[model samples]
Target: MDENQEAWYLWRHVQTQLRVSFGGIVGVDYTALRHVAGILGITLDTAMLHKIQALESVLLKKVK
Candidate 1:
């Protein structure tokens, strides 16, 4: 896959992980997640993170 596609794939994978990790928690702090992503070398902007969180929220709602 190309760079953009690769980024999206990684983002999706991370998002799914975050959803599962935080889905059962009371407060999901995205700042911590973003920091962890950065530490893991995931180059995601705030806008992208916001989009991922939005998508995750939708998925969580559906799964509920």
Candidate 2:
């Protein structure tokens, strides 16, 4: 595939997986999402890392 098409495909793939990962994290825990992503060979981007961290902070606050 061409560079442009390949980039698009990778972008779409990540986007699709991110949806499912976020859904799982929201329903379960952030670690569950990280585990699943690791099993699926997906790496978290900086933005996603920040998001998960933020969610963890929010959840911790709710717990306390």
Positional deviation of residue 18's Cα in model 2 after best superposition, in angstroms: 20
Q: Write model 2 residue lDDT over 30-53, tens digit each, in one string.
A: 455666556656566676566555
lDDT of 2 at 55: 50
Name the best candidate (by TM-score): 1
TM-score of each: 0.45, 0.40
Model 2 Cα displacement at 28 (Å)?
Answer: 11
How far off is residue 43 in model 2, in Å? 2.9
Which parts of model 1 have CA positions greater than 4 angstroms off? 1-7, 15-42
Candidate 2 at residue 51, lDDT? 54
The candidate that wins on lDDT is 1
